[model samples]
Target: MLARLTIFVLILMLLAIGWKAWAYRKSALSALRKVEVISERFTRTDFFEEDNRRWIDSGERPDVVFMGASITSRWNPEGKLGDLAVAQRGVGGQWPSHYLLRFRSDVVDLHPRAVVFKACAITFRPGVNDKGTRRAILDLTAEAEEAGIKPVLATCVPVREDGNTVYGSDGKKLPDGINDRMLPFNDWLRTLAAERGYPVIDFYRAMADDRGFLPADLAVDDIHPNDRGYEVMTATAKPILETLLGAGRG
Candidate 1:
């Protein structure tokens, strides 16, 4: 009788907590829509434009290069894979779809021995604009392979689904869930990588909870990850990326 009572009370507590979260989601999403509107002012610049000016000026390219958005920019594989020379060139708010468009100049020109591409979660809609994004990554990897550069593709990290206002209206945010569009893009990349014979880094599984959402602590806002999240990404990516770079050395 005591155990059952305890369980019942716990269940009630959980329900109360869940209800509160649901209640606040509308407000959080309302704020998000406003930010998205303002964020448009920050045009997608070169991934290595700002703080990493030294990396370009140093004229010393690493054996491996990591490129993507804020996630990759903040990734420091120090201590764990410090011996493996790697350059980080991440642009905040960049989508793979955008990265592909500038692949030749930003990545291919660098001529690193290997490139670790941290493919962020679906920023494109599959069966619509995503085909182009997929092709761009594929084309860039093919170019890398032809140039004898290893390309390591990483699975996108899971993000909070409730707050994305991309598919919503003006003042009122829509009920955009995880299965909306990004999931399909991720699926496409995974299958496409297999067919194209590229090594993949499955970062999603490491960060996602059982219900398939990024744990609240791992991410700071919605898609952007905090330091701890990057730590998890670096841990999952180091081994596979190292092996790919090692093979190039031999």
Candidate 2:
């Protein structure tokens, strides 16, 4: 009788585990589908190979190309990065994984001499799955190297949110660990860029206010930066962008 009971319990446990896994998979798929729907409206399909095709076909290779989420798209590259030939392809609410998948088409195909990676602050928050930002960066860099295009990484900007959102509803906030995780991630990126001989721009430190939080004015929303914030980013990035443009290729 005890053996039968033990067998029944084991089966029940397995069933429970299977159900939970199925539910999680369903939720992840739902989120990914939403991302695709949004990407269609925002991303450039021929961004890499066929981007600025007219210009490239005319034998005009762009000096630089910037890719990321909203930060890259919304910012006026002309005003921000200078009057160089640049193609901006930023989709809001994107993670590194999405960027990796699109890199070949969006960035690599463009035949740009250099690629600028502007990481959005939202990516540092929770709800993003897989191995997190580090894995995303590593994959992106690897892919870029294989294509013979150098990647310039930037740190994730600050957010007003104290931490990540708690899962489910109790209206209670869980230990999101966003800020805590972000600092180390930025540090790691800086070190990684140095080790790989890639240039890293440190915007996280530049964007901080006296209180060590992203100023409310710089961002109309807690996550997205406003024009003022973009202005700051552009001003800060001008020197490096110009230097890179002038340096030319190896």
Pick the lDDT winner. Answer: 2
Q: Predicted candidate 1: what Cα RMSD to the true structure?
A: 21.1
Residue pairs in candidate 1 whose N, alpha carbon or C atoms collide under 3 angstroms:
none
Candidate number with greatest TM-score: 2
Residue 4 in candidate 2 has what lDDT?
Answer: 100
- Enumerate clash totals for all models, in the order shown: 0, 4
49: Cα error in model 2, Å: 9.4
- Compared with the true structure, model 2 gives a TM-score of 0.72
- Tens-digit lDDT string for candidate 2 (66-98): 778877767765644556677787777776767
lDDT of 1 at 234: 75
